[model samples]
Target: MTKHEDQRLRIIDRRTLWNGFINLEQITLEQMMSDGSTARLVREVHDHGRAATILLFDPERQMVVLVRQLRLPVFLQGESGYLIEAPAGLLDGEAPEVAICREAMEETGYHIESALHLFDAYMSPGSITERTSFFLGRIDTSKKVAPGGGLAHEGEDIEVLEIPFEEAIAMIRTGEVCDAKTIMLLQWAMLNRAALSG
Candidate 1:
């Protein structure tokens, strides 16, 4: 790798603060020699670190569970004020499986089995340091019900909805499934639905 790439990887500054989030230092661009090119902009982002999310699906029932809640960002964007999202939460020192299972129970009121990690990636490279680990979980249909509201302390008022697999896919096509993570998870489920059903 070039010197600029190396510099970008290095953390030049870091500040830890309250409110459970840290602000990372800005990356300084540097000039480096590379194969036949103008000066490259070498800058790195300080991220919010890793998080975990789950797509709770019941293979036997051909249904996937999602939650609806008001998202402030969408609200600011003049939306109708609710977003459909997967069951998710930050790692907060817990393992991804543990975190997702707990989130499923807390957010949906269903005792979910351990989840399988599908993949992990950055949410938005442009500005956010939010890396989310996406998981696939198996839930029983008998447990499917309204998740009720979320923790009032956190200002979360969530409503759980268990939609049929085909209907969920149709929603995605209709642009109703807007959340990136949820979309990705649903696509993954679509690909594996048959095998998962067997």
Candidate 2:
């Protein structure tokens, strides 16, 4: 058996709880503990499929392109519903590179020929089954090809923002930029600023 098989984990039961734009399911599982005892546990999982996000940077101008949109969850939690985030969207069966590129164009009007694949991460591993691919793409803000505010049919009213790199970092401290993915990419840019100019 493989190393994973040695753990002795089994699924007891699984049932769909909801099916809509996202899928929710209840799952019960059994696993062998470190003390050689078996334990059963039940949990709910949210599956929204895989997704991708990209940070668009203009090295010459030292600015970053971002988007702001309403998020019901944040509003329900008593905070501003609009969130400033890196351009991102569900892959929907497309390749990570292709999905991120399309999202950038549709949300920011920046035509990205290609992007550097930085990493992939599970934003919330405990319950959500979404794994997002992170990328960095250089952009020329002077070459905007379209007026991108997202699709009206999909109810997306996105506001595009261009902030200086230093100011963007300061916004993080002030909580103006609170999206986890955007924060991560901004921190990455800080750590790799030297390479970004090249």
The best candidate by lDDT is: 2
lDDT of 2 at 143: 95
23-109: candidate 2 lDDT, tens digit per residue:
999999998898989999999999989999999999999999999999999999999899999999999899999999999999998
True lDDT of residue 53, candidate 2 = 98
Task: Return the TM-score for each candidate structure.
Answer: 0.81, 0.96
| lDDT at residue 161 of model 2 (Cα atoms) | 99
- For residues 57-154, write the lDDT of model 1, one tens digit per residue: 88877888898988787889988869898978888888878988888887887776567878898898786678888888888969645455678887
Write down the lDDT of every candidate, Cα atoms only. 0.76, 0.94
> Cα miss at 21, model 2 (Å)?
1.3
